[model samples]
Target: MAVEEILERLTRGVRDMDEELAAEAAQDALANQMPALTAINDGLVRGMNEAGRLYETQEYFVPELLLCSDAMYAGLGILSPHIQRAEEESRAKVVIGVMQGDTHDIGKNLVKLMLEVDGFEVFDLGRDVTPADFVAKVKETGAELLGMSTLMSTTMDAMGVAIRMLQQEGLREQTTVMIGGGPISQAFADLIGADGYAENATGAVREARRLLASRGAAVR
Candidate 1:
């Protein structure tokens, strides 16, 4: 299959949210018959961009976005190791999670999938991640960005605690922290001393890349 054909097929599946077709597209890429990295990337991520826009415009809700994200991940997973080589580069590493005392994970999960498509190697800490654990992962993985998610006002302080712990632990110099969730705000992030905050998952990815570029992998 030529890159053009591969692109058309893959994008069609993504726009339609057809997981089986997306899988087939992955198989085609794995086969590497046409060397179509850009085609594959655009199909996977452009579909996601559409889904994100739909979510922002209220044309689609969280459930729909979640499903679409799943579809995108399915395709990206098949392209995982090849995405970098085929695309000729790799993005930086990032750690993402839902904060301690917060059980919500849908937002963080979506952010994870998109960042993967964008070529970031994401280490997901999952739900109920403690400040100590967040700091430890930064040390362990040498990740440039640490993304925290919290859905409750009560648990929002946990995000701050994670940042402070990183500082007190003397590891804040190595990691940039970004927080998100319904109850979080830019103002709250500043008060909490987070390096960045986003209104949504897409903003998180954008802010994360920017932080990594300017800070040279240091935050606090």
Candidate 2:
């Protein structure tokens, strides 16, 4: 297929939530020597952006968004390994997790997916992550950003704890903190001394970019 045709197939596959088709299109793009970044940015990410728009307009709900992300990842799995090391290495590293005591991860997972599609190298810490673990991961990875999520109001304090841990570890200045999930608010984020707050996956991606830019961190 022509590059345009391949890109169209990749885009349509994500828009239609067809995992197999997205993967196939991604393979075709790779076989055609299309740049992996081009296929991702021009195809998968474009489709995910449309899905985000629909979600904001209420035309697509959580379920639909999840499916769309599935398609996006399907393409990503096929293309990401083929990306040039220099290009891949340029992506900013980000640490993400669900706060301790909270088992919910749907929101966190979505944010991770969006960040990956946007070219951020994400280290997902999974659910019920401890403040020490978050701090440890940041120290170990030297990540530029930390994103946390929790669905339970009771578990929200863990976000604050994690921040304090970062400060205590002397990593606070080096890392930008962002929080989200249904129970989290901008006011709450500010109160906890978080660097940023986002209500959803789309907003998280935007906030992450803004935070990185503010820190003079290079973002591809």
Candidate 3:
């Protein structure tokens, strides 16, 4: 099959929430000698982005979104291993997690996938992560970027607490912090002294890249 045809299949598979089709198309892309990165960014990511848009418009809900993510991951499992690793050492490192007191992680998971596709070395701390754990991971990894999210207004304060911990550890100057989730806004980010704020997963990737570039750090 043509590269375009295979890529479209991959995108359609994810957008339609068909995991088997996505996996098959991913295999086809590899068999056709297509670059793994191209297949991911141009195919799976595009599909996931569309799914996100659908969710934003209320055409799809959390369940549909999760199914699409499953399809995307099905493809990713096949293509991710094929990504070139020669420049791995130069990629920026990111530590991401949902704040304490919140179990919502769909948004965080999407952001994580986008960051990985964009060539960042990601360490995901999963849901209900404590402020101390966030700081500890950043200190351990010497990560340049720290991303935190929360769906509840009550849990939002934990993001600020995490930032404070980073500051107390003297890691604030070296880490670029980004905050997001349903209750988060740019004003909140500024109030919490975060380096940036992202309203969505795509915005998260853009903000991450821009923040890293502004710091003269390698991105992509």
Candidate 4:
């Protein structure tokens, strides 16, 4: 099959939530000597982006989105190890998590996948992460970027608390903080003294790159 055809198959597999097809297409891409990054960004990510749009329009619900993510990750599992070390080198370290009291992590997981595809070394803290846990991870990893998300308005305050804790620990200056989720906005990010905000997973990757670049950090 042509490379374009293989990539299309990969995209279709994820968009259609077919894990087997996605894995098959991913293997084909590798056999064809296609760049793993290209397969991920142009294939899997594009499929996930379409799935996201479908969810936004209410054409797909959480179950469908989760299936799509599974298919995408199936492809990613095949492609990730093939990424060139040269591309991985100098990538910024990022710490990401959902705030305490918020168990909705679909958004956070999508952002984490996008960030990984963009070559960021991400340490996922998972959902319901406490402020102290986030601070501890940041300190332990010496991560240059910190990303937090919450789907609940009530738990939004935890983002600010995390930021304040980072400041108290003297880690705020070295970390570029970014926030997003259903209840999050640029205003909230600004209000919490965050370095950046994104409205969606793709935007999260863009914002992360821009924030890191502004800090003289190398981002591929």
**What lDDT score is found at residue 115 in candidate 3?**
84
User: Per-model C-alpha lDDT, please?
Assistant: 0.78, 0.91, 0.90, 0.90
RMSD to the true structure for each prediction, in A, is 3.0, 1.3, 2.3, 2.6
- How would the candidate models be sorted by TM-score, starting from the highest? 2, 1, 3, 4
C-alpha lDDT (0 to 100) for residue 116 of candidate 2: 87
- Taking all chains together, the TM-score of candidate 1 against the true structure is 0.87
TM per candidate: 0.87, 0.95, 0.87, 0.84
Could you give candidate 2's per-residue lDDT for residues 1-220 as a string of tens digits?
A: 7899998889888878899999999999999999998999899988888888888888988898889989998898889888887666578999999989999998899899889888899999999999899889999999999998999999999899999989998999989999999899999999999999998899899999998998898897
Better of 1 and 4 by lDDT: 4
The whole-model C-alpha lDDT of candidate 3 against the native structure comes to 0.90
Clashes in model 3: which pairs?
Answer: none
- Cα lDDT for residue 78, model 3? 99
Model 4 Cα lDDT, one tens digit per residue, 1-220:
7989998999999999999999999999999999998898889988887887787788987788789989999999999999886655677889999999989998899889778766788999999999999999999999999999999999999999999999999999999999999999999999989999998787788888888878887675
Candidate 3 local lDDT, 101-207, one digit each (tens): 99999889988977876668899999999999999999999999999999999999989899999999999999999999999999999998999998877779889
Compose the digit string of candidate 1's lDDT tens values, residues 1-220. Answer: 6766666667766666777787788788667654445645667777777777777788888878777776776786677656446455655778888888889998889888877767688899899998889889988888888899888998889888888888897878877888889999999989988889888877777888788878865331
Q: Which regions of candidate 4 deviate over 4 angstroms? A: 33-35, 49-64, 84-87
**Candidate number with greatest TM-score:** 2
Cα misplacement distance, residue 51 of candidate 2 (Å): 1.2
